[model samples]
Target: MKSKHLILIFLLIVSAKSRAQTNHQTIEVAQVDSKKNNCVEIPSTFSHEILSESKSLNALKSKKIRRVELIYTRYKENADFDQNQLNEDRMSRLNQLLPKLQIDKPEIVWIEQIGATTSTDAKNYFHGFRIYTDVAPVARTYQRTHLNDLANPAVDFLIDNTIGGTFSHPSGTQIHIPANAVIYDNGKPVFGKYTISYSEYRNAAEILFSGLPMEFKDKTGSYLFNSAGMYEIRGTKDGQTLALQKDLSIDFNCTKNEAGVNFYEMNDQTGEWNLLKSDLFSANNPNETPSAKPEIMSANSEQRIKRGVAPDNYETEGSSKVYQQLNLVYGLISSKFGVYNCDQIFRIANKTIISPKYLDVSSKKPIKNQNMICLIDKDVNASFSFGVKQITCNSQGENIFLLFTEDGEIYALKSEKDKRVNLNQKEPEFLMENITNKVKTSDDLKSYLNI
Candidate 1:
């Protein structure tokens, strides 16, 4: 009887310990904060860290995240049908770069042949692919690891840069990679070549983009603690301006109350780092097709469309006139009106890429008012709005425009430099544009404007 009692007591103790440990590990489960749709939102800190980190960027944890999207673009094919060969080389190089990452072979996603007309430059067949990975965040893992809690001083320093309470906004950063420009790791406001085209990498090693220089070290793009409490690399390519970045390759894990923070060793001593267990998933603008709308753009501003130019480098006279024109429109909205409230875009789509990105503007806000917009860079990448300001990103950019009226109507057309001049430019008109009209509401906003 005594022996039996001792065995039972021991089993109970072991069971309780096992349960405690399980609870201690971090897991991301999706819980609908609002019922409009199902999405996995990163904690505010996570989004800020991820954006700031994406700036330093570029890769993630393996076990915690089981997938990633590999994206690339080519301007011209080499002489000997080498376009395919080159793509293969790049894909192989990526796999080799992330030996630990579980990614499959690359498959062609888009093949474009352009001529010198409205679109500049001609090219042979272009090939690219979206490689799925279960092991990757080459550097971003560090931030995700400490999401629930701050671990190291370096991370702590970075976390401060990420969004915080009192003030929270997306990282509207656009880093452009001009032709042959010296890729600086950390000379300007943000560190990155921003120049991530095939013309930029030039080598297999560059595919990894992790150890370029300490300047481009993204704290959030490091390592994270997986469900098993094991450390691994993982980070999603938040957005890219590849030729025309169609949309973001979204990597997400649903949550009950919305949390995807994977913990790590240097985690808080005692905090709610691992309270939930959920499955993480990945998404992207798989087959993004640019909008083919023929609309008149009264874009006459120069400051708005500058890519690769940081907030500090705004006055480059040689920047794109077209880019500046659009920027002028955006500038008008910002200066006159309030910061876009995530559901407002003052101007219509000037240019749309082939890649598709389902603009996610806080599905949780019941009465939220923010509009998002996207554009492509150099015909290879796209930029999504981080907030109101449109910054170039990984092949995709999203900006939220604010509306000053109820029923989500009335967008302000303010001008940059507080000048109330309207450049006499007509808002971008999309005609025959292959734009995707999402039927989110019973009545379409376009219908109200008779678009």
Candidate 2:
């Protein structure tokens, strides 16, 4: 009886151990499957409608996310496309919706996976983000790491809300506000004195430093803007924001009187430029320099003038009628106070897409950690930010490429007029000349780009 009981007990113990091993294997497989399931696939093409329906974005809203891993696959065939720009655009869209969803911003980790040279499955091309709640967050590197250190300071003006008046910048830009035009965000009319902070970006260096998106999209296609000038205006009363109850007249001053330019207002949240109005350019009289003497309604107006609010480079030759004629004044009536641009749509006639390998002049090795790559079309007054692998530009336009490093270094590549790229080579090589020490200021950069 004792031997029989021992045998039964031994069998029971073996059964229990067997069951434990099986359960352990099952749990391991389940964890692997859960990780795979956490990766939500997103569409290859990005749009506002598609973004609204993103599963990953919805997960962010519903769950307590510890971290997010954005996975992008780079295919060999589309190697020349800018993957970083696409990711940035998607992130921008996500950032815009996060506030509305009342979700805290998660730490996003960008991961670039190399796809097979010949991918047969369509799923291989899909990009996505993996959400984690249980796991600890890990450090990750991002590709879109451009630093915007240069900024033009805003010129502040104190204006009476009861009696509105015109304020002018030394750059000849004017803003004409009307009485009782200021209102708070809640539609209450603001009383007493308010301050208007205004800034202007007139050149390539200013535009680049301002970090404004020059690209515009419409139903037809994407286009670049040949900016005549750009301005930012904001109203504040005792540190609280104020808005315009009525349209404020703007006389945007520029050196060039380019025709067919339109007014555009930038969406601050999305960084998208919207077309506001047309017929913006008005020929100014040769004898009149609007910016030469600004009319302000302030007790210290004379002190402001004496301080030389006008930029020295923009000083009009009071003696030369030709110089005054070159000073173009464009008109705009806007009810919104924000960043506005006077720009002409530049349609590339002959588009050339190139993936030029950037090399440092000193070491002759590949440049790493490039913060931003800018291509300025000197002929059309347009600028382009480069993608990770490819840059698209007008084949015949006079172009200059500027590559900014992470450490504030600059490298430049000037293309010869009418022959921007060599079509014969599969991968073109651009030997970038270091211009970091040369460009000390915005004016210096403008001179270097010859814009």
Candidate 3:
């Protein structure tokens, strides 16, 4: 009797334990069904909130409706997700599979721009387009950190962009595309490329963003996709959001007529860019070609060329006469200034001192012993002579100089075209200054002259 009782007790205990295990499994399955599946889901409440917050909807006359349609043609054909799976909790499994995937909620959305373009044509037509996106905050952060890492493909595959990559299942396969390939969000034509591959995917598409119309209240706006798979993006011409202003720092060389300096860029009459030949001053060109290129100094330190004239040969049969006039001016100035340093001499010989001032041959010779100086304009085209209250003037001819005195007498460098020098009749202008009493060394002279 005792043995039989013990056996009965053991079987009862085993039966109860088995029932408990089965109940546990059933509860687990039920819990899985109750929890959410997709990481991001937009319910009707979110849709209503977005509409109200965006203030793009109206109930009055004609309710202009804009919506984002997730053409699920590819998803239905390629994805193996069951109807139940769309609403089931897969975060636990996804977390195990992809440790990098960290975003709490990620959803597909659309960004639209109204009056996004201004016509360069005659009509000045305005156009606009829509952009689709599936980028999440966490995923954006991860991409920044691990741009080149392919180790966690699941992070990019699942949460970042569900519509991207090869979606393979028993039914069919949807090949992953470059973001640029997804140009057409719905039926509207977007401006730039929409590419989303393993390499890079920019969710925002830059169209004619600069000239968006001012009447469009929200020139650029975003809309969330409702769980029902529709996102209404309303864009109206009320008042526009300005496109971002940019301060661009771009570097470019200005057009300069430096005689011997090689100009790499030149514009023609029709405004087409052209480059002068490198061997413009080669010795081979004995024939004076009318199309003869301007002379440029060679790279050689020993050989120097100035305005098509070489150092060894100052005058040639058909060289520029401007050089001859400049040489004459240089000799006169050097003789009066007690010989400038080599650099100053080079600057003068190069015809670099704003163009040489020519004495008006028509005007009568001026009285001698007057305080005067030659002034060259910033532009090398014109020059002049000016009478001043006995102040020194530097001859570099690059910058203008000013002189002031306690007696309220102000003298400035004269840059008018008509002020000419009579090289033959008058002394060199550099020597006319009150040198003995007022002028000092070259430094003091430069300071007084204000080169």
Candidate 3 per-residue C-alpha lDDT over 364-435 given as tens digits, one digit per residue, 9 for 90 to 100: 232233222333334231122222322122333343332222222223333333653322322233212223
Each prediction's RMSD to truth: 25.7, 14.2, 34.4
Clashes of 1: 94
Evaluated with lDDT, which candidate comes out highest? 2
Task: Please give the CA lDDT of all the candidate structures.
Answer: 0.22, 0.62, 0.22
lDDT tens per residue, model 1, 1-451: 9999999999997676444311011111111111111111111111011111121113433322233222222333333444434434443444444455443322223222222222122211112222332222312232233211211111000111122111100111122112222212222232332322111111111111111111111224322121211111111112422121111111111111112322111111111122121221112212122243222111112234222222433332322211111111010011110001111111223432221122223332222243322221222111122222122222122221212111222232212234322222223211111112322221222222221
What's the TM-score of every candidate structure?
0.20, 0.63, 0.13
* Candidate 3 displacement at residue 397 in angstroms: 11
Q: Which 10 consecutive residues of model 1 have the lowest summed lDDT?
A: 329-338
Return the lDDT, model 2, position 34: 15
lDDT string for model 2 (1-451, tens) is 9999999999997676444310000000000111333345444432112354565666656656555555555543466766555665565555565553235444466655442345453244445445554331010011123233345566787888888887656665567788888899889888789988887877777777666778887878778888888888899987889888888887666656657677889865445679887645534333243455554432225423311134334332221111223344534777788888888886777776666788987789988766557877777665567543556776666778887766667789888765565633545777889987787666677877777
> What C-alpha lDDT does candidate 1 achieve relative to the native structure?
0.22
Ten residues in sequence with the least summed lDDT for candidate 3: 205-214
Ranking by TM-score: 2, 1, 3
RMSD of 3: 34.4
After superposition, candidate 1 runs with Cα above 4 Å error: 1-59, 62-79, 103-428, 431-451
